[model samples]
Target: MKKILIPIWLLGLAAGCQEAPVEASFAASETAVRFVGAGPAATRTVVEADGTEISVVWGSDDVIGIFGRGATAGNNYPYAAAPERNEPSQCTFASTDMDKIFKWNRGEQAFYAYYPYAEDADAEPNALPVVLPTQQMQNGPGSTEHLAGLGVMKAAPVTRVFSEEDPAPVGFTFRNLFAMVEIRLKMAPGTAVDVPVRRIRLLSEAAPLTIGAGTVDLTAPVADDPLDITDGKKEAVLVFGEQPVLNKTDYQSFWLMLAPGRHPEGTLALEVTAIDNSTCTTTLPAVAFKANCNYRQDAALSLDEFVPAEAFNATAAVTECRVGEPVVFALSGEAETVDFYSGEKFHQWEYADKDRLEYSDVFFSFRAQMQGGAQLHPLTVKVSTDFDGTFEEPNILTAAWTDVTTRFTLPTKPWTANNGPNTLERYLEEGRMISSGEVNLSAYYDEKSPYLYVAFFYHVDKYDATLKNSRPGIWFTDIMAVRAEGDTRIPILSQTKETVHIVNGDKYAEGEAGSDWQGTPYEYNGTTISPLRMWCVNNPPGDRDAYAVTNKLERKVSNFGPDKPESVKGGGNGDAPRLQLRVCGTGNLRNRTGGPEQDAHRRNGNGLPLYGDGKTLRS
Candidate 1:
């Protein structure tokens, strides 16, 4: 048996329009042709029709495609109510387009009509090319404009006999072609009640929302059976006009239109996306949607466990640099607030392992050997509190450097050579290592500066080929700086490649202490190597045993103990040494007991880790 679904609105067939019951109603007129209601009245008022409350009214620009009997095509004729019809009550419809007027002939004729008139939509009056749009717009509450976009309705055929002197009203038994869904959403028990909802999607694999472009066979027998939506989409989205906030006390209503079908249990769900781009889903029970019927679904949405992935990210240009040099950090992402842990004395992420209240003393240790030159003043240690990160010469010369060279012991003469002066290969071994006792650096620690720079000024006063004052080759190894509080030594710096920025400055002229080195470029085995101010790890250019520069500052044997250096290979491209400052070890830094890390990973909080450049350390 086929269920005859009635229309939810009515159009009065008489001049003095009045409300009628759900059953069929008819009226007759002498001059003008009118449409009567066979199902429900079309008005803006919330009227009970067929045991459902709906408000459907005739708009001012309504049009209908009407087909006369024995004709294959239909004419699109516009219809509207009277000029004074404004209230939510029954009204009559008359032709609005002057050129497309519909008249009856003196014979028995049957007429077929469909709402939402289109010009090219013509078939055998059975297979009308009806397309349901996927994206539906929302106007407001109780506004049928959203439903008007996807709603398709057709009237049952009506037969009448017309004469020149006598005219009668035509009644239509209109029926809807699709099903309706009304969703009522509320906040879950622990969810925030004020989060705004952006969109809601209805998903079901067994029951699709819409079919591809196809013809609707209006001549089908049954109206309640599942519509043929074999090739259709699995999801239908409903966008809200005003992103309404959720409340636990009341429910917000949203409407959607989809194909009429039966959705299997456990395959239907509603996903809601909030304004913050977080999503929440709730399952819907099994349901069978019939044509011309609206199903109301009530569900709760919880946003408590949804954490947006694009919250915050940070990356430093250079992870470790000299103290006076600037630290450039590039930050991105969106957040309500952000905190930057500088890893300085008191601003470290590991607060428990912060620097002591008052440092007892600051000192440095180094191993160096001076070879070739009679003058032992080629190397000096200096400290500055105002040097930027730029490696230019004028910037370095303008900065005030405090001479701290006298605080440490430097090598005075060349180590005992195993062979001649030009072939003294024993300097590359660990036996010639000269240890500089712990030198005080407490006077240069400025409390106002965020960083301090310690530079090793290695320069030759004059390059004399006669060996009178020629630049001596100097090698430094196992260099370290620390802060002492009683017996607790906190490492302030080390010589590692990643911790130092080395520049040879100019490789041409040398006279003043800060001038570019003018050491001659010598050819060695076809490669021209410049031996000027080279801060390299292996031997300097030309392989002269007296002036070959090398360093084992990056030796990995022990923290602060004298160990054999790595076997020295003779090349200028060998890895140079670097030093890092003020490293602290934290046992349980990211404590799960409290703070932002714990709060971010708390219950119902998605455990989103704070993303940053992994090169940065807390201490």
Candidate 2:
């Protein structure tokens, strides 16, 4: 994903070698050897020059190593061109001592020449030794001064008649023995604007160049064999004397000379270092270089964004939490972006491992009690995979619910003292508020859905409510669900009073149906009265009060108002509030009343029905 495409142009390295006009005649007194480039037929094209032709003229300090089959065979015949004459591609050369100029030998003479003269080379021109510099310095684009020591060029042998009849200088056309690469670097598309690039290094374990002294056989055909590099190098660093800001629209060219060969794929990596010392690297494609070829590699360097690892810090509030639990965390330091990891098997940091079919076991827990003569079981836990987020009764009734009530235990007898023995009172004295033990709810979990709706249906048939005993009110507390993973238990869905909400599920208006109230004994005695309900709070000391859904559900002695022994009110022990549910009417009290009538209960987190005013809940 971090890679970008770069176009490259490969062409032959062209150093215009042309023949000059022959002179009328040579003076007998002038015994100097004159030289000119080969004819136009051997000329190569230049890709980035002022014109279509590019010429390499001799420098003031330039010298060429020549070998003549006659007297110059045992010792090198160094030829120095005058500064004035060196301005042109064709020039006349003389020995270090002007008096000892090159002289014509007897018979048909044979001669050879090479430039960037190497002192370590043997006197024999057939096998000359040369070495290239590994460190290259560039002044600016199109500059070739650094190529003087790195570029190796050799001219073909020239055989001509040395008679007075011939006055024209013998010409030798030079051909580069190695390849040249013109790297035109520019900012990649979408890269940061104006990145001050300080340096770029080309690295390859394949040893792309032969930097050590090597022997080149001039006798053999140039293309017949490759250069014999005695010692090769794996990397080359190009240092820009002037630090330039990279531009996305234009490219800056830098040239390098390398021994020609096939560089394998993934063998070359370009490391670009910015002015701030940050660096990024990209691999180059495979390429085969040939002698005398100029590979103009246009690379769009990519440095999308750089962030140091030391600039980030994140701390979690707790080491572990249950599934669906609100895990708190504190983030510090800086970053361009951040992603959360749930620490689950499939939900890892890796992009590919984000989904799975397996899921952990879930459990539901709650405490319940029934008063009066509630003959029919009231609480039934049902699950729905698809539940639209709304309090509309039609929407809840239309949703498909799978009855999972058989999974948990339900109370079989009433707990009020008038109805039966005070079974709920005896349990409350022991601090065992959560009477119904945790029940496994894995059967309702659907991996395909993000949330599972669990609804507690508290309803009684109106036909069986003729006697006050038939309308027994049910109580529920500590209602919650959690995920079980080995020994660890993760909170799946839990809510407090602040998060619970109540909505109109029937024809009645919103606030009128689900309002909290204190029910009087007369209300419960009425045969046609609706179900009486109220909120109460009285949690025991040194308990998990925060985890309890409701503090208490049974009416205390303080709630009795000098009425029948069975009378109930909505006030807990003197200080805390209490709630009581009583049936007083003959109308149907079912959650779904067959037609459009439904219960008025709003849903909280994870699609669970709640019993508070319609408002956002705080878990």
Candidate 3:
């Protein structure tokens, strides 16, 4: 049968007067009464009425209290209190006073009732019972104190009036004042082992209720509400023995009777203490609970698996210059220069003769030969912000330069001729290479400056250095600064040939007996027949070579050996033929034989033998 559950707060009542003549009947609804317990069978009961035994399910313990009002009454009187079930389903009132009989239709009358009547056994005979405090109302039974166990206390009211002409069964609807809560433990999926549940408890802020006038003052402050009950003692906590397992299939379950209140804001905390385990305890936050409501909460606690973070692998594509085809730098003393001989060709500074060289502003690019594994290294490309057409005034290292490497997005392909322009593949087979794209320098370009000092360096960490030579070397090709406006290629560095004058056996030569190359000697040989005295240039004659013979040459053979020369023969007679060469104007002439300097000597300057003291051709 369906039974209506109700909630009520008992209060101090006025004295009840004698009941007038009234007739009434009561019957329960078809709704089954819900029992709050550890399980479903806690609410079973049997009711007897008029010598007939009826198996009726009471919501809680088998106890009932009824109060009635007559047709002309001053106050409601408690007329019947039945604490247990009779044999034949017949419930008889304790009071047999017939003066309070039912009268036909004088005024409306009703009955008020509550379950577990003995819970209020200390009440006065004709007066209402003293209302219990909210905390004391829903307390569990203590070992030393016999308090009410986990059960429901409801207040049912009947509003129907009875008469002989139209008899109506009075229906009562009960309302429980306390909320029912059931807690169960579970484990998360893939949890291989079970953890024992040592203890469980709720946590919340406390707000007590003051009992009066058939209602509760929910605004009262409590000294021992959920928030105040932190001792976790037997009176304040719901204790449980240590369970063997707390897993998905096997776990601990229990119920708790909490005081009725609106817990709308803060969460209802359930702290579960696991038995001697690595993960000792866990608290389930934000468990919601409402006043006078039934709650079934399942908490799942799982151990988080350990997973390591991923490592960073940085890669890049660099373009490199081929051997014998490097982007040569001009011999400008402004930039630091280092020369190493690799191939047959001498790779000297291109514009070493010029006093100053200017290069157009353009993009610079190269291939970076990264030797280390997949690791990100700092590659900085800085350009002089205020070059000011000079290399000395502002040192390139200390001068103001903006790093433009970050401005360009470099390609990340490994250096290979197949992926690069031109015949880079053949070069790769010979050596390692990195293909780098054009790094734009348009932002820092200045048209007025004679030359822009630029530098490229790699700041690699020493830990990531895995090459035989820890120091990495970068090669570059197509390394011209081109001005896009006019498609002009700046002359930063260019190869040039020059004829350098050399004297055989001269003190200024590489190995000589007496040479004043660094300083002028006080007394130098004006003329001599010593085989070393025969002047000769060291370079061989070729299509690219030119010689300017100002004074007529006297051909002679001179001994050339590490030991001293024995004698000198005239007109190409010794083992090595010797041609007497003369140094004319400006003995420090370039390597090229017939160039602008030779032309100038033939035009305006005197054709004097550079070796003699301006006296005779043979001198």
- The candidate that wins on TM-score is 2
Q: Estimate each model's TM-score.
A: 0.42, 0.43, 0.29
The worst-scoring run of ten residues by lDDT in candidate 2 lies at 539-548
> What Cα-based lDDT does every candidate model obtain?
0.50, 0.50, 0.32
Residues 252-271, candidate 2: write the lDDT tens digits.
77777777767788887776
Model 3 reaches what TM-score against the true structure? 0.29
Model 3: number of backbone collisions:
45
* Residue-level error in angstroms, candidate 2, position 559: 99
Residues 1-619 of candidate 3: C-alpha lDDT, one tens digit per residue? 1111111211111100111122244422232111111111112222211111112234222444555455523122223433224331223333223453333334566445444454344342233332322222212211201123433333333455434444334433333444445455567667787665434556555432222223321112211121222122111234443233566564344445555444333433444444431232333333333333444555566645211112111111112232323222111111011222121212121222322223334555444333222324434556764634333312333457676776544434234333222233333344444445665455564544434555543332233324322322222332333344346444332111111111122122344222111111122143111110111122211111111101111111222222111121211111222212222222211222122222112111343212111110000
Distance from true position, residue 287, model 1, in Å? 0.9
The C-alpha stretches of model 2 lying farther than 4 A from their native spots are 13-32, 39-55, 71-74, 82-87, 98-100, 119-123, 224-226, 305-619
- Of candidates 3 and 2, the better by lDDT: 2
